[model samples]
Target: MLMSPTVRSGTLVMLIALLRSPATTVAVPPPSSVQASAIGADVTAGKHLFERHCAVCHGIEGKGGRGPGLNRAQLAHAPDDTALKSVISDGISPDMPAGWFLTDEDVANLAAYVRSFSNIPSEPLPGDAVRGAGVYAKGGCSNCHIVAGAGFGYGPELSNIGIRRSAPYIRKAIVKPGATMPEGFLLVEAITPSGDKIEGIRVNEDTFSIQIKDATGQFHSLRKQDLKELQKLRGESPMPSYGGVFNTSELDDLVAYLASLRGKQ
Candidate 1:
């Protein structure tokens, strides 16, 4: 019962095609119990690592304090697992110090733990965003903070602050500005050779020269050698604490308004 030459060639071609097709491959099942156990262990280890190394800045629950919240479904800088791992290892420059002591495995575990935070729901804002905008204007917040190309550039920009910082962190900042003075906004007081004292946030500095932006929004580049006195006020913030100014409701409203500023969204 030999097939015709044409039929034989067609059959051979079909057989080869079948052999090369992905449909012929076996489907892999989900991870086995042992593999699942290993992953669970990794996540547990990562949790411990986060508590020890990251909890101080990121908050004990990863809700955020000095750093951005990890509990959100998405992070601006770390949109995926790979980016999260890299950020944990390399850090984000002057704002976030690199995890120099962490090993590859440690970083993986830490990322897993941080990723777990996404499951936790974001906290709800207590105040009205509309009222908060009024509070912001009344408090003259724009004088120090910038939002969407408006306001001064003196303090940290709030254009995307809603996505970057948690509401609690923003509230804490408003109530106690000195608690976390941010990375770049270092307060400095310099005395000129002619007995003139100038105080401002340190814009930039080197061994020979220092640049300062005074409260009056003036830029002063002074030579270190010519200054009679140069005082670096570490852990000090030029932004005044608004604890006394804003009542409880006003404070809540302001926090809500700032948290609503997601920028271009």
Candidate 2:
């Protein structure tokens, strides 16, 4: 693959990894909107909109989830700021439904947040996205994580994980499930009145009831009175550490494929 000529090869590989690094820089696409890119425009407002409206499918930080990540070298349908506004206002076909509900100001603010992704320093990497996809299928990540909206909702969706996390972070997460836990995933153990034992991911719970989903996608809902045990193991997750599961090359390939998934169908 032809590496981007903009940066040194080594730096490019590390570009997406150092999103917050001062040295890391993404080429800001030429701004087409004077109003949207205005300094007075509230970047914070845009971030809020993204977190509220777009985070479900696009990811918390424009990283991607069910939708393609906005943090990318280039956009698929729109590139310039003005075009981005149209994308936000009109929404696109196939997958990206329109957001006609947003006000003009909301569109302006959201555009700023989307534009910010261009400067996040995601150039490219050595790992291959296609082969990495095969790795994902083989690794059984879909059993827990969702990609392109097809998987058990038990685990965090990985459609936009590449943009949400860096290559090294992704690698570290695979080998260390306990290191960080996504927002809602909490390990739980439930024992029935008959002394039947169950351990799986805690899906949801209420004062009177609890729900958990196992690896097989079987959901077990237990009332608080019936269960012999229910424990919320904080700082814990059901995802197993892949340290011994994959070799170094396989890990790299998997990471590459995951990073390439920016919500594209």
Candidate 3:
């Protein structure tokens, strides 16, 4: 039936109002199987890339070896997806080199694969954390290491060692300190023109000057020309082997104590 112009306009207005109302329902389509497959393929490709480029340092399963572990839900440096991608592309200085060869899509896929490691369950620790604390105290570990700003700063700050290192890695480190003498902790001996020998960890070095922090936590800045001798004790670590210091159970307890120290949060 034919309607007047005013009646038709009123009907159209009512229809528009109804569509805009809260009661209105709209169906959104789920992602297609093909799209899902593409995503899966990207992740697979990323895993391959990681194996080729990152596995040397990060391990086959991202459990870590020379570099820090990526199996946890959170990464200290790369907290979010965007940050993760940036790290993969740019890399951390001194220790980690940048992925200058990776394309943008390659970086995305690598990030995806790294993120997948977070879903895997963390390995359970066996030692009692409380007992481990006592073991640590008895071992004189605070003489060199620092935890949550409590101990000496001669060694690396271990506030986030739990997140950075795996249980096996920590165990090995405790038993054989020389095996995993952290990067950048190079020992050196310098003999000045005055015939005084100073031995310590090399803090920083440049073209003109070198800095050293001795066993007593003293800093020495010397010019390269003024020194009679500057010897880099490569493949040597001042941190002694504790293999004979602690029994098996005590070692396990120490590992647990160190593992439980997952930063402020």
Stretches of model 3 off by over 4 angstroms after superposition = 1-41
Locate the minimum summed-lDDT window of 10 residues in model 3: 32-41
How close to the true structure is residue 36 of candidate 2, measured as C-alpha lDDT?
31
- Which tens-of-lDDT digit does each residue in 126-182 have in candidate 1? 899999999998999899888888899888889988866678889989988888666
- Ordering by TM-score: 1, 3, 2
TM-score of each: 0.80, 0.58, 0.80
The TM-score of candidate 1 is: 0.80
* lDDT tens per residue, model 3, 1-265: 1112244655645644554465652521243322222232256668899999999888899987767678887787777776777898998865577999999879877886787787677667789999999999999999998998888988777887876666777888877777777667689999999999999999999999999999899999999999999999987778888899899889989989988888986
Clashing pairs in 2: 64-160, 67-263, 68-262, 68-263, 69-262
Tens-digit lDDT track for model 2 on 46-147? Answer: 888888888876778776554656776567566567788898888765346688899988997788668777656654667777888888889888878899
- C-alpha positional error of residue 258 in candidate 1 after TM-score superposition, expressed in Å: 1.4
lDDT of each: 0.79, 0.72, 0.78
